[model samples]
Target: MTRYTPALATALAVLLPVSATADSFTATIAAGHPPVFRWIRMISDTFIPTVTAELEKSGHTITFDEQYGGALAKVGEELEAVEAGLAELGTCQSLFDPAKLAVQNVTYYTPFVSADLRKVGEVIDSLHADLPAMTEAYGENGVVYIGAPITIDDYLLMTNFPVESLADLDGRKIAAPGAAINWLSGTGAVGVAGNLTTYYNEIKTGVYDGVLVFASAALPGKLYEVAPYVTRAGLGAQYAGSLCANADWYEGLPDDVKAALKTGADAARDWYTTELETAVGVSLEKMAEAGATVTNAPDAMRAAWAKGMENAAAKWAAELDAQGKPATEVLTTYMEAMRAAGATPLRDWDKE
Candidate 1:
């Protein structure tokens, strides 16, 4: 038991009248890939800084726990991790998580459409904001879109041997990511499900003869050392993933904090697309200088390659539509948007 005096009581009264204001927030940002990738790098370089700056204007601060290289989540598992609250936010790779994000893979199913990374990134980001259907999967997974769209540059075939024609791919073990594997149909090539992380070693060790990869990644991965023949077959740029936050965690944030996150994401998107646009040309040039033989497929060969493949888009849309996913609608909308933006697709995936 203790005695309470007037001075002690006054001191306690003065010290205990604290306000219940939250001036800070803590977030854990996860990515399956390491910071070597431009998209991952932008998280640290652009997204975090932009968010911090915006929050500071309103007398708020945020602390971010950056997790990359599968330290927190592996590729295709980020969405689940965020949904389960293992992380507050992550890059939800729709391209890899095709079953969960079927509608998000519309671009992959409809290849040979556009190679413009800027256009694809802008259009896809717009869709995410303007189209409720675009974000339906996120809601189902207990996550919400936070932007920072990842637009892969034009995909090219990098093989150990020269590919002057489609016949060169016959019987060869070629690797592609996710839905893009379907592009191998009617090409006579064996399409192995592979990713950028294992492409260099797999190809070098004879596990794969070649890979359908993009230049921006090929240069950093040094795939030229293994598969030196790079053929620009015009598979087109792709919307692989985007930033997502745990629905509960995001909703709990203050309005200003949420606005800051959006601002950060928009800044990151602009930075990423500009960097990717520059990287495509620079990566190809560097790979060529490093002894990789680079060639563009002939017009006839490109046309034949596109014509030979099965209508994967129609099949994919039909399958998802049967499952009650708005894949067909998303596909049609994407194609219309692309066409309206001046893209001349080799095949009308939605119309046909």
Candidate 2:
């Protein structure tokens, strides 16, 4: 025998425990959108590969049972669907879950904080590090936020009407999805219910005159196929969605698997962001070449709207505070960071 000693045996025993501790877990992710959509690919392909690869590297195995394109949940019910433990995880747009995911909308209230999706995304991710209070809001409904926060590309105005100034926007039927309608509040533009999917059709049918949509999603969605006037209103992108997990499912996961999933989530966030950032430029070019009339919203209008947001921000913050969520902190942190980053608010619709 080479060496049969207690000290050597003890060393081997310790290494054995270390090696034995690595294990894998199976995670199921849910999405209500098609796999071809960029959002879906991030979750099903990019996130899956990144996380599973990380787990395997760390001696953990991760298998995903993915449900996309509403195979598991309806389009708008992702928050509830995830919370009810239907699927282990899903991508949810906070704006869509107004009652449940109210806390995540803090940055949306403080507009122009970041036109750069990546920067806004970083702040949100950093804030989400230990947002148990925020999570508790989700947890109360049986959902948990894991991995990364979801940030959207900047909201641009693709309109049937020409808007160079606030005056041009007066009395026009403005189709704004979610809280973005608040952005058009006082301009005499009627806030109609329209999301990216419906905007182009609504425009074609004369349901609304214009749309507030992001280039990343809209270009792929081809909203310009209906609306010809695409104005670069330059409303900063919002941190609009999140990667949410089923609390019960998450708790059931092994520690190593949980860590692997988180690693995967980070990879997915970066991948989604990279695609979003690239899409913005590319979408605009395609829209421009396709005969969409494009122009920048005037500085005066942007300044005017920025001034009006005070009351809206305060009201939105207070709403969150009443719910016992850290809305004020989230809002304040975002506004301060954006200001520090040289962000000037575009419009002040909350002002009288």
Model 1: lowest-lDDT 10 consecutive positions: 13-22
Cα lDDT tens digits, model 1, 25-58, are 8999988898988899999999999999998887
lDDT of 2 at 148: 59
TM-score to true structure, per model: 0.91, 0.88
With a 3 Å backbone cut-off (N, CA, C), the pairs that clash in candidate 2 are 24-61, 302-346, 305-347, 305-348, 306-347, 306-348, 308-348, 308-350, 308-351, 309-348
Candidate 2 lDDT tens digits, 254-338? 7777787788788888988898888889988998898888788777777776554445777887777887777776666656656
- Candidate 2 Cα outliers beyond 4 Å, as residue runs: 1-22, 130-132, 308-310, 346-352
Q: Write down the worst ten-residue block by lDDT for model 2.
A: 343-352
Number of the top-ranking candidate, with TM-score as the measure: 1
RMSD of each: 5.6, 2.9
lDDT of each: 0.92, 0.75
